[model samples]
Target: MFDLDRWLEIFQTINKNKLRTLLAGFTVTLGILIFTVLFGMGNGLKNTFYTFFQDDAQNTIFIYPGFATKPFKGFKENRRIEFKNEDLALLEEKFGDRIEFTTARISKGTTVKYKSEYGNYTVRAVHPEHQYLEKTIIDRGRFINENDIEKDTRVATIGRLVEKDLFGNENAVGKYFTLNKIVYRVVGVFSDEGGDREERNIYTPVSTTQLIYKNTDKIDQINLSYDMAIGANGARRLSRDIKKVLKDKHNIAPSDRNGIYVESVIEDLEQNLQLANVLQIIVFWIGLGTLFAGVIGISNIMVYIVKERTKELGIRKALGAKPSTVIGMILQETMVITMIFGYIGLLIGNFVLNSMGNKLEDWFITNPNVSQGTIIFATVILILSGLIAGYIPARRAARVKPIVALRDE
Candidate 1:
């Protein structure tokens, strides 16, 4: 078991054709490297998608009106459809319990001013629930409340970036800001989210918006959240129910299909996650296939090595070397080459992943490392590949006859 001489002889043979051995090892290394990198990328892409959806409730739905794609009754194609406050009120009455939170929004991009300092940005009129729907958090003061909506208060919540630009470090709560010369009180300051356009917005009550913007009883869009207990299927059913109510109220056909749009956030997220899972599987298989091919190449190279060293093996056998000794030498050489290079590939892949993970995380992608199970599986594959590659050649070497091998050049 501790045959120093046998190990020395194995190294001497491998040293004889160092370049060939190295080339074979390199193929395996390159294959494993590609496998590791591609797996990391797949994980990154999945995390990116999840991050994009994180800011919004996974079960939320958005309703917006667009031109009719299909002509219905006497209505012509491409006719514009508008949503009104009455439509939202009717939906709330019909599906009150099915809804978690509901709000309507109307946005205008205009300049906001306080004294001499002016910052131009978007202003939104939203119901109290808009804060929860959009995942808006207050840095100071409070968001729009039911009291503001009920009384049509001229109170506004500003984003952190807007606060810094208009007020600097000065307290903005209870101060006043004017949008389009319509005075509104600043009741809150919100934090920013890097590239979020919403972070620069100022939010006010939907009722206040309609009154100030002369949009009485009109809304551009409706945002709502459904109970998480009402899963994707239930959400889809509720969306259809809402669509039917809108079509009936608007005097549009149920089959008109284009007069209004109702979207389920849960449905979109579920579909996207499914697609991501498929792509990840494809990535894993491609990586494993490449690694397997490299392992096969190593097996072929070992076979060739056994063939080339037949005479040397034959001389050893004639000098009382056992078949087990010959086998042990070949197996050791194969394992050493495989484990060393395979480990190197693993280390390099992990280093690359760590370096890119942070930049990817800022974009909302999560831990991009291969799963522990996957790593363990790959290690097992590596060990088995080495054993198989070595075993076949060792079996052939043990079969060689002293008389025949001695005659070989």
Candidate 2:
């Protein structure tokens, strides 16, 4: 099906109108470049949302205590709704099957000292199961154990940044660090891939912290993990039930909206899913629009070329050239220009995105990339563009007759 003569004719025609060819090629390349990068940006935005999900389990829910904004049962407004250590235990007992892991947390910024090197870092008192709630990467030794809580032993697991600040190049594990002047043995050094900012926290057993920091039986928040079988709908129902249970226990009104602050990771994940879907649809439409613009430009150029070469086309027809031959020449030229330039644009966009890697503009954009499937899609669009641009003009070329060509000035 390959015709060398048709290809030669296309090349000769394009060479004679270099500027015209360049303009047509520019339209195709520019459209493809914009479309490709839009795809990359949409991917980057999805990654930005994923970074938050990485901080905890996909099914984790966080419960932070807040004051009652409305009163109930002879109580006035603005009553404080604080969580006690007993509240978390009671919830676990009541919803053991629905919940997989649960932990109470109390955190504050305090001075930590190791051999005269001191820094202010956020110290968190958490149960042993707290490790499962956060993306805790234990770099050395172990996290707080049940033994630490049972005996109320003073033990610490410091973040990587805290370790670097307090004991650089020296092993922190098996050593002692004083927090608020109370010496606690360092059991582990941990970090988050979210970088040094998230790695500045130090964790200890909740029981020990209550004794040392005078938190007593009070807990600031509760972290919970659940099975995926209790999906987003189940999770929402559980969240509402938990809030109602706590409100009733605290004697807050049934309608008191500010009695507690309960958040579900399931809800956040669902919202993210919706946002990503919308972004994909918008990118698809915009890319199609740009591609159409390129097709229009190529179609316009082909029509002008057919008009300009009417005399030549007529002479070829008079000399017994077939109609298919005339159509083949025009189609070959359009396809050559579109395919070559569109591929170049795709390659350049991929190069720019690949060069960016993990770090890019702000934390908003990370690892922007186009998949092989998306590239295949763009190629299919190019082939259609070639067909559309050449069709009408090639048909007109085929219809040219010797008398009409002799008449055309």
Q: Best lDDT goes to which candidate?
A: 2
Q: Which residue runs does candidate 2 get wrong by more than 4 Å?
A: 321-325
CA RMSD (A), model 1: 3.1
Candidate 1 structure quality by residue, lDDT tens digits, 1-409: 4778767865786688888789778867877787888888788878777767777877788998877767677877777888888888888999999998999999888899998999889998999898888888888999999999889999999998888889888899999989989899999988743345768889989898888766487899988999888877899999998888887776677777778888887788778888888988999899989998888899899998888889989998999989998898888888878887887888888888787765767655566777777777777788788888789999989989998989989
Q: Per-residue lDDT tens digits of candidate 2, residues 23-74?
A: 8888888888888887887888788778757888888989987878886788
Q: Which residue pairs of candidate 2 clash?
A: none
Residue 282 displacement (Å), model 1: 3.5
C-alpha lDDT of residue 311 in model 2: 89
lDDT of 1: 0.84
